[model samples]
Target: KIKNWLSAPDSSRNMNEAYGKLQDGTCSWFFEGEQFSTWKEEPSFLWVKGKGKFLLVSLSSIIHNVDLAKQDSSLSMAYFFFDGRDSQTELQLHHKLIRSLIWQLSYREDHKVPLPLVNLYKKYGHQQPLDRVLRDRSFRWIALQIEELKKCASKNEIQKKLGKLPRGLDETYQRILKGIDRDYWDDTKIFLQFLAFSKRPLKVDELAEVITVDLGSEEGPAFIEDKQYQDPRIVLTRCSSLFLLLYLLNKTSGIIKLSHFSVKEYLLSPMLTKELFMSDAAFTNWVQLWNIDLNIWDQKRSRDKTDVMKMASALYYASLAGIKPTVELLLTNKAEVNAQGGWWGNALQAASAECHRDIVELLLVNKADVNAQGGDYGNALQAASFHGHRDIVELLLQNKAEVNAQGGYHGNALQAASARGYKYNVELLLINEAAVNAEGGYHGNALQAASAEGHRDIVELLLQNKAEVNAQGGEYGNALQAASFHGHRDIVELLLQNKAEVNAQGGEYQNALQAASAGGHRNIVELLLQNKAEVNAQGGYYGNALQAASTGGHRDIVELLLQNKAEVNAQGGYYGNALKAASHWGHRDIVELLLQNKADVNAQGGEYGNALQAASFHGHRDIVELLLVNKAEVNAQGGEYGNALQAASAEGHMDIMELLQEKDAINEDHKEEFSTE
Candidate 1:
């Protein structure tokens, strides 16, 4: 049936659709090329020809028949396909393969399923439906099997049973390792070491670039530009039979990862490292390789070459990795103790950021620069504070690492800790006399960062420490505006209680009331209003609280602002006035409310000229008609498309244009407006 369907002229066999069907049990056959001939020996399995491929089916009947042939056998057969396109699918396939083996082992010709196998089935089977299990891509099946194995009478019995299993990942990996020639063994070992130990996944090109560079050369590291850019494939070729066991090809990104995370776990095992002749020195070398400068000469002539070279060393990576032995080995070999390189800038900073207390202490003991000012967090103090590594922060402080160093992502240690809501770290910094109102980071100051993140305790602490509540600089304007925008009612209340100026205007949303209205925080808007917030204040992103509320389609907030006596025809925001904002967003109800509240339908300003022009431009014919019915000047010329009729015509809204034309809205001036273009 499948073959005939495939051969049909109208056959629409999408690979993804077929795969989905097979997974859902709606399809039992999978298409393959002529290569499927190898499985023809299996009597239970059938292959049928398709247009240019064959459909292979191994259903329940085939499985039952196969079990009958091996009713009394102790050994089970399992087959796995590694070409799965995704991790979830791959894991599900693994479960299916394992289940099949267990199913075969459970069968007996003379009796019911064996007690152990039956118990195993009862424990793991039918608990989670197959569809739900696959959807979640759970590891429950694997965990159940491991638990069953633990119930074996003895370790020897468990080993004996496991010995009968098919060649698994570990065995396959060992086999590949054994097959590699001695000539390429060292290079392969080093390459695998990098994959096994590196903190982040190395890109294929990056791995290739690093491996081809000679790190030991005196003329600094030389980048072999002519080397194969597609080095992952080359590495696989060099490892030969072992490639599949070691690496998993991510088809979407073309980046190769370890076949499974377990592969790295196996490679990192002490016994495997010993067998492969890998040592701390080799690990240090791998770290050194990551830092080698390809453009060494160009960098040397630059202003800060020493700092750059130091930044690109093994000590920084080893410190980042938190590998004490490798770090000690590198330090012993006279690796730059305070080498500045990588993202964190220096070894101390890297160690500090990752909360590697031991390494941080080691670098400090080696007389590493305590106040280095370069990396993402600026110095060790800020790095530790940013990551909430209290012990490391204390250590850096004890070593007199400058607490007020101004640079990196959050500007200073105090702001970094406060921004991340690290109460203890913030207190420690404050105790050490760090500036509470330091102004120069991403969030302007600690108070604003704390307020923006909705950290009430941090905000209170900063306020208590005399931090400026109205410090206007960061992304969100002021503490009150930031808190209001993010819907942090308690924080907003606290700021207000701390004397945050209710009418202060400056940031992205201009004022607290507008920010609150824009974010749809009705309660905050109400709170700001109660605090005597200026409802008609204009400036900032959305102009006024009513306009901001209207732009966001917050009908209740808009109504509240209107009740507070907000200007109905206020003109400043991106959408001109509240009426235009409501019309542009197609909020007919809000438009009705605004129009009933005496909003000017012909108010001309902002991105769209008037409410009619905004409504017509956006293809909101009902809104355009409503505006016109409400006495909007249709012939009014302004905004991007000149007038309402021209705006409708420009957007190809013929129905709206016809309505406008029927009203005689398009005048000679409107015609001239389009003629010039």
Candidate 2:
């Protein structure tokens, strides 16, 4: 691919055409310019250096020992002339190197030279004398032309050449402003600013959703009509030149990015941004334009109103972007410091969540609400804790933010920090007197949260800090259950050593043993069993430990449980019995093992009527045959699809149906003879 690109005609074209294609959004802006000599015979290592607008390609070793003696004289003279006269920047050094190679290729006639060089020699050898070319004024003029081509190739220079150079992102954006119809200018400008300043690339649908939100209304942004959610290309049509869709290898998934990295640089440039707010009037106009109104409106009246206020203001975007100056400018213009809307809820939360310490400090100084609630993380502290922003957490804490505030994904700041395994932050929260037993979040409390994530150190810390080890609340019921379910044997052992009740029931999986069995954690299951966990103790998603292991097709666990005297025909839980559960999932080996252990083949319970029906329904012919040979009642009726024959027939299994019918007929013959006797 590199060789084909280097040899292509496009490589020889001037930068003007290349930059034109890039700006017009007709070509990708990833052009490569060779910076190192390719004429060397040794293995060449290509090094890529990204300069202002173009990628400079160079070689690690410019010349092999064989080529050096032949090509050294001419190449050295060119380099000496360019190097001694001027102190060149890296880009300029690359330019000089490329120009010297062009000169060498233009005049050299040696057949031993590389093919690309040979081709160039064939084209330009007759035009100039090889040795005297550097001394000739006309050859110097050709050098000047190549320099001009380099300038044209630069994205920045291309913009300047086309008379489209804006002082910064705002100026370039103003061009987009001019092109948009006045009706869309307000909403469109807001959307463009988000595209320019967001921390991460926005999906096409996300952009659409944000723009249509009326930030001015207090009741929250109204959902735009479905018709307004048009294709992404349509949304970006007027300013298509400024954006490009970066398609993934799948071609279906893509995110929007600026056409060139320079575009982002221009937007972020301090000089250009300063020009945007040179006057109070200009600043106020920008503020008003960017401000989202948070006033509530009558639903009936709002439906007819096309120009709803935006949900996020300029302050929100500035905070999200970490543009300190823009944030200061918005604040000075009285952009609401406590505005409660948008994805982050407010500017302070956005800054805190993003870990922009300077911005967070600035917002705090501006008296932004440190305890403001309502967003994904519920408040700034929780957001900071969730993302492990220790500095931000410290700052918020110093500002008298509530230490025990209850809200957000993890319920509170401590739980959030603990869940994510932020040990230092968890320590900080604990030092600040964060509630040790705070409940009500994703993981019921800090201990369970730590246990669920397998953070042994955090679990130890919580336990040492007097956390309720056997505290019965959370997604997994308690810390021990949470650890066992996730196969965290070490944490489970720790919880157990801390005196967590081994038989403690109440979670998606009833107890520690059942949870371990369901998760296929044989070691944890064994440990729980060793610790005297009730093997037949029922009550969870699966009723018993043996059934749980059977449901998960853990044949070893099943055999181990049976060896420990687990009831083979025990009933209860999702599949009703161990044999039924094993048969349902078509684990032939487990089914045979259970049958050998004298599991009642005619055990009539569970989602399927019996073990025979469970096997037949799932098309496990061998298990069905095994069960039939063991005298499982062929006509046993009871369960979801009626009987074994009906179950097989319902699932379109003809062979199982034939076997069941043959067995039923034989049973009928036996019954008839007994009745006659």
User: What TM-score does model 2 achieve against the real structure?
Assistant: 0.62
User: Against the hidden true structure, what lDDT does model 1 obtain?
Assistant: 0.69
Best-fitting candidate, scored by lDDT: 1
**Residue range with the least summed lDDT across 10 consecutive positions in model 2:** 56-65
Off by over 4 Å in 1: 1-165, 174-190, 215-254, 266-281, 291-311, 633-636, 643-677
Tens digits of per-residue lDDT for model 2, 616-648: 878888889999898888888789976777678
TM-score of each: 0.67, 0.62
Per-residue lDDT of candidate 1, residues 352-421 (tens digit): 8778899888888888998988877788898889768899888888888788989887889998898778
What is the clash count of model 2? Answer: 13
- For residue 543, model 2's alpha carbon misses the true position, in angstroms, by 0.6
